[model samples]
Target chain A: MIPASFDYVRATSLSHAIGLLQDDPDGNKLVAGGHTLIPTLKLRLASPALLIDISGIDELRGIEVADCIRIGALTTHAELLASKPLREVLPIFHQAADMIADPQVRNRGTIGGSLANADPAADWPAVVIALKGELELAGPTRRRRIAARDFFVDIMTTALEPGEVLVAIHMPRPNRGAKFRYRKIRHPASGYAVVGVAATLCLRDDIVSEVMIAITGATSRAFAADSASTHLIGKPLSTENIAMAASLTGEQAECLSDHYASADYRKHLVKTEVSRALASLNGA
Target chain B: MTDHTEELHVVTVDVNGVRRTASVEARKLLVHLLRDDLGLTGTHVGCDTSQCGACTVDIDGQAVKSCTVLAVMTSGSSITTIEGLARGGGALHPVQAAFHEHHALQCGFCTPGMIMSVRQMLGQNPNPTESEIRHGLAGNICRCTGYNNIVRAVQSLASEAPRHD
Candidate 1:
């Protein structure tokens, strides 16, 4: 598939990218991995006048593993899956990365592109939401941070302002005693999640101290199952309670339907995968 | 070499141990650059939608789907195609030999891309189990239903000396 002709400029630095976007926010689209944007362009779904290539920026790469985890927006899925420090600190990342497209796609598709694109089936939003990540945005004038919970608006929509670019994601490492899990039913052809659920639970003295659950691929946008999560807090960590919470997932959101899966089936997946994810951590 | 209405980009790359440069349009795909401009047609394009791995090639050290990659974005990178797999003496790559010995192909249309992906999997993990091999080859589709032999071919290499990718 061939894309329409468009002007391309490689952004030399983060500020350069911000400046380019600020100059032509509506006409230019920033490309890091180009895995998502190039396909959309090839299909003529989007035809911007210019493309600012942010893949070459040195500042938008690497993972910092300290008390607070910092991940560059351009960090590829392979990098996340391969980082021993990241895995040791947060296993949810590699778990989600492992289920993301194939090895070749992972080698090229960046986390920033995946999140910014806001593809319904993309895995990072739910993972970030469950882990309570803080997305850092850089604009021409200033920098701001937004919680992952408030970042996503809808499919292909984000809270990012015009002329702003997502630069990094910062989040405190989950407590050492906490357990995290991400589970998904993979679509055979596309490798996207039919329905995916990411959950984090901290159990102390046989009681749930903290819990977060986010469901993706089962709604217009990824959403935190706040009711379900709240139901589990201060309760006994039991399979029955887990199942009850899983049943509450996607209770408010309307799911999207396509040739691959129906909305009803996706709803079924939310409950199934959530229960499975929570059950996986039941013994731990 | 020629530009008309669209803006052109100057891209340079090392392919099959040779450094080559080409001026292409901003929309040109890496697969076309290799086949049309650089004359390395061994890298096939089966599914242009990026689902199939026919256009798989080694970019730097990663096996990437060339159809999904823009030529201009890959400037200054090293790319290796199926044509580069043969040794200096024209000997087939060990994976290719295994495929040939095991009759791992039917129509052979997916052979080059499949081999490239297999080389990548083996490069990452010298000895992968049956399920891992299957999972690793999930992205590359062989329509001839020759997956059994292909799996066996990959399995046969596990007993040999570790291949340095």
Candidate 2:
């Protein structure tokens, strides 16, 4: 379906994009990579009078690492998959990028766009929540950093205010001697996760020291599986503990019913995928 | 006129080594610009949604769903379509030749998207394993040929010719 008619404004710079949005009282929307928003617009799920295309903005399009790996909002999945730095230093980014929608979707979809859309089925949100990432948002007034945990409020909702644009995503340096793994049950058509789990653990002689687990696609928003993580922490990697943690995730997660799958099925998937994710971590 | 100049919306883009300039609505999809405005009909539109990659085109050296990209988004970018796959003198692209030689297409409904995707796959990884080829073409779905011949065509190109898409 064609999107409703709307005026398009080209933002030559970051400030120009902000200006366009600030001028619109009803609020102008930023279009970067338009992989998600465009579809939403087409379905009339969202209707913004003015669309400020920020894909042309040069500032938001690269991956840099100093104290942390900072990814520009416009960085495409295809670019992430081909990034030598990300592959060498943080392989999980590439692994997550590989599982996103199809190749065509990845080529045009942006990290910032997905984060801003906050689709529960999106894979990146799960990764960000697990890594304790920070989002750098630029608004007409000021810039603020929102924790990935707090950034996502619910499905199709975020902590973003009007006239604010997600500028970049900041991921802390991976802890040394840390083992990480993520697994997902992807929706066959859209490649969206039916259930996804991202787990990072600092293992000391096969016992969990620092464990962080984030669950996505099983609820309205990406959430930390605190109960599950607590179960794994200070415990040896064994089948018994893994089963206990997986069970805790089922109890802690707020599953939703949808046409694609039922709430019960999602719970079951959360249980199975968490177990599998833990197993992969142990094997690695 | 609201004191705002009616800025010239002229865009000159390089498509298939030929330059194209047209004044278009800001809301026009790139597929419309290429097919209706520039008369490049080889890029077919199967579904308006981005799900079907039938409207696939190479934009700025990357394969993207043309149906979702605005024409203005690609104002200065280079594009490659099915018509541009062959050489100026009628030499078919290696991937296209392989598809024809292997009978990879039946109804040809999804030929353009399949061909464009194959071009990108071979360009990215000239020699992809069988499983890699399957994953690579996972985005491009085909009802006919059952994907067996398509896989063979890509595999054949990967092994023997050493040609880039």
Best by TM-score: 1
TM-score of each: 0.96, 0.95
Top of the candidates by DockQ: 1
Error of 1 at B25 (Å): 0.5
lDDT of 1 by residue, A100-203 (tens): 88888888999999888888888999999999999999988889999998999988899999999999999898887889999998888787877889999999
The residue ranges of model 1 lying beyond 4 angstroms of the native Cα positions read B1-5, B87-89, B159-165
Computed on C-alphas against the true complex, the DockQ of each candidate is 0.49, 0.43
* Model 1, backbone clash pairs (residues 3+ apart or across chains), number: 0
